[model samples]
Target: MNHNIIFQKIETVDLADVAAIEQQCYPNPWPIKTMQDCLDADYQCLKGLTELSPEIRCYAFMMIGHEEAHLLKITVHPAHRKKGLAQAMLHRLTLIARINHARKIWLEVRTSNDEAIRFYRRAGFEIKGKRRNYYRYKDHNGKQIKEDALVMCYSLI
Candidate 1:
């Protein structure tokens, strides 16, 4: 783990690298255009850079509402995993949510993604509910499959 990881606001130009990491992190990564939409008015995108290079090693995309913040996605570059980058991004997002007057932070993770679920729990998020067939993707055979999602929440107030 590098102790010099730096977190900053994500820019449109950074999307390509962000998208690359997205593909590696999920079975169904958001399309590049979809990730572009995350730059809309209500969303906040944060990325982590290390050692003065312009490359982003991790990112957190979030949507902010009147009283809550929703974590749309978070990912760590494959080479940067186990380096606490995700945790750093999560903490930065939490502070951003609080600064925006949000009372809570919310997110959904694929039920099959136990590692992420554990990570979120460690970040103080608790399972609040479940959504059936919340995510759709193709399995190894290329057949469409749907997966349940675990809804989780964290208090910011």
Candidate 2:
């Protein structure tokens, strides 16, 4: 773990750079307005964790309700991936969730993303179920398509 990295609540002003990182990380990402809306709606957790001299290299958005937390999105910049950033952020979020009385944290990942599925498993998330046609995107030829999503959850209580 990098001692220099710091986690802070995300702000609307950080959305542009956050959007750029999102574009780099995902095939399809939530729009900037969507992120802003998360903040405006008082999502349970919206944090940006900085790395390597205070740049916002990683971020996450989560919503906690009725003793459960839903991780809307979590991302690490390409240049910053793998160096314990994701795990560290996950730790932070889990702590926050537990502190807020959340018994578990949940998220949906694209089934096609094997690496992410493995990573989540490594981080103690268990595959709970699958959602058919959970994600939609255009293929390289520009044909629209849908992808299944794997539901995963991590116990916090």
lDDT of candidates 1 onward, in order: 0.88, 0.84
- Candidate 1: tens digits of C-alpha lDDT, residues 1-157: 3468888888788888888888788899888888778776648888889767988888888999989999998888888788888888888888889999999999999999988999999889999999999999996689999999999999986
Task: Looking at model 1, report the run of 10 residues with the lowest lDDT sum.
Answer: 34-43
**Per-residue C-alpha lDDT of model 2 across residues 39-107, encoded as one tens digit per residue:** 998884444454546568788999989999999877878887778887888888888899889999999
**Global CA lDDT of candidate 1, please?**
0.88
| Stretches of model 1 off by over 4 angstroms after superposition | 1-3
Question: Model 2 clash tally?
Answer: 0
Count of clashes, each model:
0, 0
TM-score of each: 0.93, 0.92
Clashing pairs in 2: none
TM-score of 1: 0.93
